[model samples]
Target: MTEDHLDIKTPEYVAIQFQIAGLGSRAAAFIIDQALLMIINILAIVILFFVMDGMETSPFFLTESTFPIAVVVIGLFVLNWGYFFFFEFFSGGRTLGKRMVGIRVIQENGHSITLLSSFIRNLVRLIDSLPTAYFLGIIMIFFHPKHKRLGDLVAGTIVVHERKAKKKKKLTPIEKEINLRGLTENDLELDDWTLKSFTAKDWKLVSTYASRFHQLPVEERNQLTKQIADLLLTKKGIEVAGKTDTDLENTLLVLYLVLKDEWEFEL
Candidate 1:
């Protein structure tokens, strides 16, 4: 099952690898969530019906003034949309179903889920729900390398098992193949904040990029390298002059592996 894991380095430089949740587990969680929401909505509608009946005989104007309609619409919205948003945000990425299933949503970088990211992902649920019963979503999850649905892809989030991550003591072959021995302290401009700024998720991306660099077309490779380098440079506030995009990208990834322990103070 080591093959199914995604590696994420902890603040201590320990490799903490998480198992990506598969379609079965994810579907179970989704079904649980839907059932709970359906129950809640049923109760809400029952209450609303009684309230509307009471108002129909009175002149309070609630039943006839579009207020009841508005309430029903908002209730549906909350049940269908806000439920995921609120739970994921407050629970640090787990809704009740996800928590029950022992899985959680996390930034692809392994960071805790944020409100905005949660909102974006939940918003894309509309697209994922297209053509009934999430057929498109199931197809996407089945075919996508990472098992991400449309919402996950749009929000740059992934669902992972909540189990303790498997740690690796030694570097993988890909890590060894791309070395930073030539890059000196001056080149990395090592700082505590620099190391802290990069997360396990970011490390995963770096590893993927480096490992697949040669396989990608030149244009795509260059574009990805530049994007990765720019994000790191902007976040860490460091600059490496006199290097091409490929060189800069490789240097950043290598520096991360080499100097990961140096950032403990900042963390």
Candidate 2:
């Protein structure tokens, strides 16, 4: 199946994209969370009946103490419902399950899930779980283009894969090749006047490209390098016509080196 992507244009005019988490991944996360909640519920039951009610582990133990029964009822409500709300809101859209599954909840605009939105979604989860084992929710997810359930529809939230940007730990072969190119800041031949044209935003663009460079597939890397070269290299009065893919990437790396010292701290 074709993957679904959600794009957000920030107020700063920056664009971000996220991949919608699949049903299998969502189910895994849900199962993990449910398992945890089940364990907690069991523990809570034990404490309410055995510890507080004088070691009476009877199945119908709640009748012994009205106070303990009320507490248990309230605790059940909190554990069953409030767990998702507090965790999704306070934990940056990720519960323990979602974190482990590398998925997270976010608003439609790609912002962090808000408190109200989280509450709304979890509140509607009761309906989603109705008619036996979330049957309605599973059907809704199976049919929905973005795999949204009723709760997600009401809450304006989406489950997306968490993007963890991993910087290169060591100099890979491609990076080594770029480093060996011996193109320093001086190679660009930029003076104060020429340097003044470049901005911190430009540095960010270059640095982002540099960091993600080796991680992309060859075709994407070449295409992206060419695009960046066309967009940015011309400002430095550089020509791109005769350069190989490797040469163009090296030029970008050199540009990143030149801009790093000036704009690194500003951001």
Candidate 3:
């Protein structure tokens, strides 16, 4: 199956990759959640049935009271409307269906979603569901590159596939031998705007260079390294002089890891 990836630099300055959840997967999750809600409604109905039946035989039976009807309405409202909000807010963005589907809602910036953001997104669900069966949402998701629905767009969130835990790949002998000095914060000549302009894709490119530099053939790696350094550092008005290609590459990677979280940035 084809999957879209979102690369994000985290607070720790490490670049991470997340798989974007597609419309098909989202629809499956929604259906599963709806079925569970339906079961809840059915159980509620059964409970009401027993209560009413007991009331009929009671000496203090009162058919005149509207309390039972009001209770049912409130319960239904909570089930249909509050379910998602409650689950998302409390469960770190996973509802039962989302958990089953291995997807979750998160901010596009690689940070946990705020409570108000969650509330706003869930509130927009009414609009997304308009004209029946999330028709508007489906249309939006179809066109959006990240497959964001109306609520997600409004809330600045995206649904992503949950990352599976895996063992880290062992470093090759050459990879282990690569000794690149880390760039200190003093070395950074970047302004806020330049830093902000560097997107998740840029971070991914930097990270890939750092991780695979030692494994590449020397000539090829040097050429690739020089090209990347020129684009990010020299083009941005950052001074790069007297630094070897290897040094430039390692310095940039170190700078990326060190200052990535210092600036407030978004994708």
Best by TM-score: 2
The TM-score ranking, best first, is: 2, 3, 1
lDDT of 3 by residue, 65-182 (tens): 4567679879898778888988887888889999999998899997777798799999999999989989999999888999998899889999999999998998544334433353
Per-residue error for 123 in candidate 3, Å, reads: 0.9
Candidate 2 accuracy as TM-score? 0.63
Task: Report the Cα lDDT for candidate 2.
Answer: 0.86
Model 2 spans > 4 angstroms off: 52-64, 172-183, 187-267
Winner of 1 and 2 under TM-score: 2
Candidate lDDT scores, in order, read 0.78, 0.86, 0.80
Q: What is the TM-score of each candidate against the true structure?
A: 0.58, 0.63, 0.60
Output the lDDT of residue 116, model 3: 83
Candidate 1 worst ten-residue window by lDDT: 177-186
Q: What pairs collide in candidate 1? A: 109-201
Residue 101, model 1, lDDT: 94
